[model samples]
Target: MKLHLASAVSRLFSKILRLHYSFFSGKILSVRAICTDAENRIYLVRHSYTPGWHLPGGGVDNGVSVEEALAAELREEGNLQILGKPMLKYVYLNVEGSRREHIVLFTAQVSQPDGFSRNFEIIEGRFFSMAELPPDLDPACQRRIQEWVIGEFGAAAW
Candidate 1:
């Protein structure tokens, strides 16, 4: 479908960007936002490239601050309008890949829902209750939700 094609293109674009940056920069920095609507439900997105549902986020472009990058990602991935300053939650050292990657997690409060449509980066997105999260959610994201929402964090790993 369109989502699959979009994801493939997204992955390809990401790979090219990574390749272009690898020759100049040694580390990669990204920002992620855990946004909540007026009803307190968490908004999650499924990337066209990734298999699992994840917090709405993307890589921080060069010369952009974490907050700036997060704001751009929130707008691009979910059409979310950040109402105020986002609280820094955690700094995760992502070791899932060969490159040195760091992700800055932020808790952001957003306005009421305006509905999300399928984009080239995000195929599907929706709000979910704490007790009924999707089974295919990224484990790291799941841990984040548990730690922030339920106040239970098992390990320090991400």
Candidate 2:
């Protein structure tokens, strides 16, 4: 019941954001990192203010590159110290209607041991096997992972 309520509220907030940004002049760009450990487990996070498990990432700040934004987000949200470079995975057009939003997905490997704690933005995080992912993961996140697995390459999503 709690998860359901949270999911409903999250969806409502996202709709509101889209509607609010519809009248804006600029587009919204965000980044997500499919972080993995040496054991090949995927890092997933649950936001304090949002429902569902999602890739650890956030918006790209002004004047900051997407890679930099993703790194900052990983550190802030997951205490993730990226070992090396992040590989580009997929770039998707997040939503239609009001907001012209785009999401750049990247796959990153972390070098350090996991020790993430609850923060203001993120309340929970854990690493899970690809086949054992939480059932409540975001659908878009699942699709992105699927695309990566199949080695599909093409134009950005619409």
Best by lDDT: 1
Task: Give stretches of model 1 more than 4 Å off.
Answer: 1-3, 19-24, 151-157
Task: Give the per-residue lDDT digits (tens) of candidate 2, residues 17-129.
Answer: 76776766488888998889999898999886666898889888789999999989998887888888999876778664333778888899985455987765577888889
Tens digit of lDDT per residue, candidate 1, span 68-97?
999988888878888889988778887765
**Predictions in order: lDDT:** 0.82, 0.80
lDDT of 2 at 157: 64
Once model 1 is optimally superposed onto the true structure by TM-score, how far is the C-alpha of residue 64 displaced, in angstroms?
1.6
lDDT of 1 at 14: 71
Tell me the deviation in Å of residue 1 in model 1. 4.6
Note the residue pairs that clash in candidate 2. Answer: none
